[model samples]
Target: MYYINKITFSMFITITLLWSITLTRIYAESRECDHTKCVKTLADTTIDMLIATRSVVAKNQDLINVDPVSGNYYFKGFVPAMVGSEVANDFSLMTGHKLKQTSLKLRNPNNAPDEWEEKVLRSFEASGYPKGAGFGEALVTGDNKIYRYMKPIYVEKACLECHSTKKNLRPEIRKFLEERYPYDHAFGYKEGDVRGGISITLPFGN
Candidate 1:
């Protein structure tokens, strides 16, 4: 009788552990779905607004910056402010976390050559939208609560003047960047590469 009881207890413990794991997975999946859907919706809405307004106004043109080193078009200083105040404000109200946009340049002048560029490229290829395709979304954290949606902006021939390595970068711009960001790691990118990401982060609770 004692042996039988011990076996029964072991079986019950095993079953309970399995059941807990299954429940945890299910909950995680559900949370992921919710986060993904929220990010997608936000990206779609922001892109639509960008497309509609690109022709008429240039209020947000600062969001897109050109790097002279690699002829890459990327996001510059004021872009983050614009995103936080204008873009992220709305997203936060809708979702939970305050949204922010960031651009990681293909190469960094300061940091050691980590695989940062490669990782971004891989992520972009696997997850980013096609060239000029504009509009792809991804969940940053595995839980999917924090999400990023980005649009690809290809550098044009005209943009080469400011974005190419051959050209001289304006001193003012360089100074501005240095002062604002002591450890800026975004620079030296080529045309048609992933410049930056428009990210919306949902709060932990929500």
Candidate 2:
């Protein structure tokens, strides 16, 4: 199996978000199509962002400094999940939509799934669900309608650093996680397991 170790986590997402930034404006024209076509383009754009991000980050790791300071065992401030959250926030601001990363087992309690997200996460976990396929719906809330889009994120061999079984985690990484996220259940994942997903909400009339 291919793995790039732990430090590449932030690099992976940073690159992905950058890809989203550049392409969202380019693909914004596609949203003027019919309702079904609009939502489909949005989801497709995000997935394409992933494809391009992985390819770009693979070629560009020289900028990522994984070297550790004396006492600290692993990198901080830019962990995979944290970077993902930040990336979502920035992307949301740029596009005037709500972008979020959420998981059934959360590292950041702030990312706890709402009712809709919870139901979707359960569906993702259910056996026989298609791997890597995204789910989307137009939700009616109060007097407004909105489109919610989610695409699942799968665990890779590279993800084992912070999300593998407890026994498999390096002591310092475990300790760092314990102190940072005491209620963490975002671990014990195998390579192909569903890690979580990218959730986006577009205003109804947008």
Among all candidates shown, the one with the greatest TM-score: 2
lDDT of 1 by residue, 67-185 (tens): 43553544444332332335445445544444443444522243222343334444555643355443444434555434444544344333333344522556656665567666654
lDDT of 2 by residue, 74-176 (tens): 3443455555565667667777667677889888899988888888988999999998778888878888677787878888766777788888977867887
How high is the CA lDDT of each candidate model?
A: 0.42, 0.68
Question: What would the TM-scores of all predictions be?
Answer: 0.42, 0.77
What is the Å distance of residue 73 in model 2 from its true position?
7.2
Model 2 misplaced regions, further than 4 Å: 1-17, 20-27, 30-33, 47-65, 68-74
lDDT (Cα, 0-100) at 49 in candidate 2: 66
lDDT of 1 at 48: 43
CA RMSD of all predictions: 21.0, 5.7
Query: How many backbone collisions does model 1 have?
Result: 4
